[model samples]
Target: MDGVKKISLVIPCYNEEKNITRTLDGILEVFKSSSILAKYDFEVIAVDDGSKDATWAQIVEYAKKDNHIHGVRLMGNFGQSCGYQAGFDASTGEYVITVSADLEIPLENLAKVVELLEQGYDFVNTNRKNRWGGEKKAKSGMANKIISRVSGVCMQDRGSGMKGFSRVLVDNLKFYGDMHRFIPDYLTVYRAKMTEFDVEFKDRDFGVSAYKGSQVFWFYRSSYYRLWFLGNCVSYCAKTVGVQYWG
Candidate 1:
């Protein structure tokens, strides 16, 4: 353990009872096989976003079996970003990353993410070339493009959930509402040493997508987030550069 580093995996699961165990095993398969990754001791923080199913029970069971596993149960159904907020607050690792319990992105892709992080990138966000379902791809695509244009961040897949952050970034950033999706834009303001990596997209094997009908105002929502990002930047600059007394 002397040479090992602690890494935390924050997973936000909602009604993913059927996919809980598989998600854990998939992660195990990645680190178990790699000699480099073997030195990175991993802990799983599975946040139950008030799942109506037995997802919380499954998390509790897994935590009992593995000392590295933990379960966080929210009072009610908060959004995904809120779930991540809970997990982030509870995480105790030098490096933190997130993946869905439904296995949307291949767990194996995490190895590369770990490598990038170890190389000293404060933030690494993935660009998924192919997504599972693009039912609302047109609107989603427009949103991504708009964000990239306004934020001065060239991100192809801004909404890709495959992201990793150094503990320093985790402590400084807070997730709320759907702000997690705009992490890349905020990174520009934070001036974090960041990288963009490509990862393959995989479809979930169990349960349906929770975001099925949430894209009606996708354009409008992204506009609001864009404004939010601008507002935050103005506020951060003011706090840092204003009211300095020159003697």
Candidate 2:
């Protein structure tokens, strides 16, 4: 498998000891069943975001057993964005996929993202139609809709943990303060060919959701920052044109 094109799977874990193993097994099963393992080399990178439980220990055990499995233990709980950034920096794969440790997003759907990548998409995001076995839709549907409307970017689900990116897209990311939620928008701005596909969503059976009410407030604030950044880009372009004409 030396010098072969590989896919790096990054799972960000934070006190998800009970769910981590299941998630890993699910992913491995999907890779085995889809025959993706035989076609290309792959690595599973688990980033433990200062887990206070057995998450780090489990990751270590897996990494020791399988050379393809790797683990990164952070010094402190640095949130999901940092965990993802750490994983991305550690990955050496030509293609990368970032998934949740809770198994809310099934690994079986990864094949869809990989298929789209094969068709020339630089980034592919999962759109979960039903969550927790209910057709109630995603809880963030309204907020995401507002974000898409304000940003002029349409995506069925924003902040969906199931996302795949080419090495080009991964290498260009700069994570800061919930930037993960706006990854699709960031990729689009960078001229990366992007697409989204429907995927299954499972309810977390073991652990509680880490997203709280406070995080929801931060999400909207982060969206404002994103809009401001976009505005600044336009303003800078206008200023450049003005200077050129006046001078």
TM-score of each: 0.87, 0.85
List candidate 2 stretches off by more than 4 Å: 132-139, 212-218, 230-247
> Under the 3 Å rule for N, CA and C atoms, how many clashes does model 1 have?
0
Q: Which candidate is the best by lDDT?
A: 1
Clashing pairs in 1: none
- Find the 10 residues in a row with the least total lDDT in model 2: 238-247
Worst 10 residues of 1 by lDDT: 238-247
How many angstroms is residue 93 displaced in model 1 relative to the true structure, after the best TM-score fit?
A: 1.1
CA error at residue 156 for candidate 2, angstroms = 1.5
Tens digits of lDDT, candidate 2, 15-49 = 99998888877877777788655577888999888
| Residue lDDT tens for model 1, 67-151 | 7788888778878777777788778888999888888788878888888999999998888766734556666666677777777
RMSD of 1: 7.8
